[model samples]
Target: MKTSRLVIGILSIVLAVIVLFQSCAVGIGNALQANEEVSGSAGLMVAVILLVAGIIGIVTRNGGKGPFVAGAFYALGGILGLTNAGSYGDLILWSVVCFLFAAVFIIGNLIKKKS
Candidate 1:
């Protein structure tokens, strides 16, 4: 596996954990003050995508399509979250991060294909 994939995998997991904890801290306690945090469901969805992508990166062979598909999922999930953010304004940063990761993975995949 490429070093980029490995680094992305670890960082994705770390990001997932951060998202999860933030969601839980705000959601579970029903202490959402001014809608400055992501909703529980949305956070869970994003976190799951990140976690799955991380796992795929760590375990899959170099040429497998897991990272490519994970990239697609990251883009899809991020876009959906951004579009449906509603009153949850704090979700924007995480959504943007997802897009960044998606871009990295997709661009890396394309570069590999060309080589």
Candidate 2:
């Protein structure tokens, strides 16, 4: 359980970095050009959400509720990634990572109870 929380804490920082990087004009422009589509307003929103969540996760790292909140945030981030079909590979990757973390937390607790 503690190990899971540690991994989540680390992942939160990584997620934050990814969001911040995406906020760069070059990244946004490239994303737009790739699709030759609408601007990156929607992506920006998701990035902001991820940033906020990551910050919260870091702040609440030692709290008992940290994992729960982090899990929710991760799931939301994964969903947001999935919404951008052009980034479907990233979407699947994030979703799997988030799910695996949640599963580890749950299973670890269950095993501890049985011991």
Every model's Cα RMSD, please?
A: 3.0, 4.1
Predicted candidate 1 versus true structure: per-residue lDDT over 1-115, tens digit per residue: 3887788888989988987786666466444465544466677677788788777766652756877887887897688668756445556777898888888888888888888
Using TM-score as the measure, the top candidate is: 1
Model 2 Cα RMSD, Å?
4.1
Candidate 2, residues 1-115, lDDT tens digits: the string is: 5655666656756765664464455347757568653224434544565555556555655555554666576667556655652532343454455556555544554565567
Full-model lDDT for every candidate:
0.74, 0.55
